[model samples]
Target: MAHRCARLCGVTALGGSMTRCVLATLLLLALPVPAWPQSAPARPVAEDPEITAALALVEARLETERIRRKIPGLSAAVVYDQQILWSKGFGFADVERRIPATPRTIYRVASITKLFTATMLMQLRDAGKVGLEDPVTRYVPELQLRSRFADSPPITLLQLATHTSGLSREAPMDYWRTLRFPAVEAMVAALTQDGERIFPPYREWKYSNVGYAILGLALSRAAGQPYFDYVEQNILRPLGMHDSGFQPTAGLATGYALPEGDAPPKPVFQPDYGGYGPATSLYTHVEDIAKFISLQFRDGPVGGNQILRGSSLREMHAAHWIQPDWQSGWGIGFRITRIGSYTAIGHGGGIQGFRTDVSLIPALKLGVAVFTNTNSDPDELTAMVLELLGPVVERAQQRSRPAPPPAPAEWRHYLGVYRTDFGSRVRIRLHEHRLEMVPAEEPAATPVVLTAIAPHQFRMQGGWASGEVLRFEVDSQGQVTGVWIGAYPARKEALPE
Candidate 1:
């Protein structure tokens, strides 16, 4: 069981007037408002010393870890309910320029932007402009697929949102290297002509950026607005996310540190993808993302008005599909997981030089958003934040529910041999009930323990890859057939008996 700190942190209250004063003070000092309240909440008025100490420890450890990992800079925030408990920036935002990361520094959120895309789709559903079950071909008739399976089933908007559209993780050709903002029409055409369905649509779950790119195009067609413009009007503006948008204009911090020894970070070349972003290109500061997190908590509003209906939020939180092993489930737009007795809903994002994590615990009316400008591991940081805030959230729950036991062993039955079409076979074995994948002919392969997520689904720990859920399929005889690993594009072929 992951240890939860028992220390209680006294809560502090900042009135709306006082918050305004603080903002004014920050503006005068030219310092960023690291902490800002999205809305006032009734809670204990004293800051918890123990909680503060724990948080300090976490911050210190993160700084050390960043240096040790060769990560150049980081900016992070923590929120509870709608209140900003704490936010801070560490290291250099621009290593070459010696500029420190600040609350105002904007970082590429990568796939975390997908949540916004999904939320926009939900908003369209609320407005009766789009249906979740509507066929993709309905909006974009030119959409096609290489395989009959990909084209025959008639992909739905929901499938694209949830990544069951049978599209590859990315386009067959390297769009990142070849093109700058290739037309959606060209992308769909290329996918239709060259893409192969690694798995049958809706038969399993696979994470696909192509799916989201298609969804972005479909949403634009449905709304009769450019993708970024539609999101700005419907989602960003209404959410009061002034600091959040698809592109970073002048005044935003730049020259962020790239991963050491990794590819050097370059300026975003394509204005179309960066400017007309959807799915994976939104830029945001930590405090703004906290506001978004609070809105997700419970009955909170977008732009001080309820934009998503209560039913819609519930549908967003409800499990949309069960993974193959049945250990964890995925909701409409969020990845669902239970840590200890608390249920968490949110997503994690990774780009070249940044990592972002947002988690919401509605039962406690609490949420957390952590953003870093340096590409480093977020798992430990997330665990620490949750640990610091755990006691307070538990107190709010009003019930002493013991931590849930680790997932059961039947979930491990899917562990076996898998062969890739490239004549490579890998063996997934159970060690201490955790799945360890070993590639054949690799003598010293480091094994990544597959953390039980839902049913036959599991995710690897550490970094941006932690939130991905791997699903395994079975034959009629209940033997493992093939496995579709989420995040990565390739599927693992089951080895012959």
Candidate 2:
């Protein structure tokens, strides 16, 4: 029968129905049918319906503001977790050529450059080659600026990173007005002769571009490499920010001075920061900036390079010096700002005709970057984005957050009331797959979480007993009898039917 069906299938391929013949042959021989290969399902995008709706609202607001402010061109992006949720541009990169601005349109990012310098310094600090408490003079002994207060402590690297170094705000030259920045050696020499410490070290937070310039020079000396080289090799390249550079480069958007009244916008000539590049000389686009923003959201590598440690990034985000207003402060290289219930850490930049702002909301793992060709407060755009998109992403995260893993089957043996030797009673309950110790008297209070570290040992989270080891005592029958919380014994109560 198989031979006859095989011959029938071959004959049908020449004229008759081949599908029917093949089916008959397979049935006769009872051969398994081969399956066609299936293509993989499409990956889910980061933007969901809620996020899309919020993005529409954000786009409307951005367009309205871009026109109202008379910005020639601008770019903006929103990052959630480790992904860029949305990015776009408005107006024209070159109004004369009618070139439309896009997320790839490059612009001078100004003071945002300080963040790169800060990250490099933090990397060196974490590598144990330099100490945060080390004096600035240790690296730059050629620095001869004088302090008015004799009792003031010598300036430290921490003070420099936090903007409390008491250094002058500029490089002791008319660089901003002249647009002719000095070289590193000449700038340091001029500063030594003309500059004076504005305030005692750590006395107050005084923003000093020259302080960061000095820091970069000192960092170079400590790392035994050029400052820009260190940052480029360790940070920009590792983060794959190839479009970013400290000099004028291709794809740069023409910057325009803020137009006066109805007069046409005047294009401003771009200038290089020279020795002060570390503080305000970065030229980049929204796409590369998005990569940097994603770095702030997680600790792992990007394209196989670990830019900075997660703990160090957290330290950089923490407030090192707070302003008198209580709403603003300075982190290592970031600006700490408070908006209602949210705490944002990032930086703002403005030089000549360009303006930019970046804000990272650590709690939500969300960030926003706004870049404009013409001078304007990009921070306003950032605030609106956070207000509009932040809540939606946060709620979505809460909804999508995976449920806790199922409790172990053996966990039931440890659940019950425990009477401590000190006459205190605590109840161990399995709530939401977590082992929590609830006070018997105040069950309404927040319970302390217990995390399993071994077969019968757990660690307590929070309270005065944080980090203390907890061991469950088991009987020969494998039933839990009591628990030992750092040598303090607690007897378990009998289970009721």
Q: Which model scores highest in TM-score?
A: 2
Worst 10 residues of 1 by lDDT: 2-11
Q: Deviation in angstroms for 429 in model 1?
A: 50
Residue 283: error of model 2 in Å?
0.7
lDDT to native, each model: 0.66, 0.81
Report the C-alpha lDDT of model 1 over 1-497, residue by residue, as the tens digit: 11111111111133344334433332333332222232323335125433444455445545555655656666677776667777777777766677887766777777788888888899888778899999998998887665655345778999888887666787776657654657667778777778766666777788887788888888888888988888777777777888888767543555344544665544333234632256678888888888777777656433344567667787888888778776656777788777557777778887655677777777666666666665566655665567556754454333223333454666556656666656666667765445666675663577656776676677865334555776787668876667765644334454433
Candidate 1, residue 277: Cα displacement in angstroms equals 2.3
Off by over 4 Å in 2: 1-48, 127-129, 300-303, 324-326, 405-427, 437-453, 456-497
TM-scores of the candidates in the order shown: 0.66, 0.80
Query: Per-residue lDDT for 1-497 in model 2, tens only?
Result: 64465454333222234334444433433333222222322223353455665675566567667877889898998888777788899998888888899999998998999999899888999888899999988998878887788877778888988999888788678877888888767778887898788899777788988888888888999999988788888998888899988777888888999988988778888776788878888889988998888888777422365588888888999999888889799989999997547998889999888999998799888899999988899998898789766666666565454456789989998888889988999888888788988787787878888999999999999766789998999999998999997779999975721
- Compared with the true structure, the alpha-carbon lDDT of candidate 1 equals 0.66
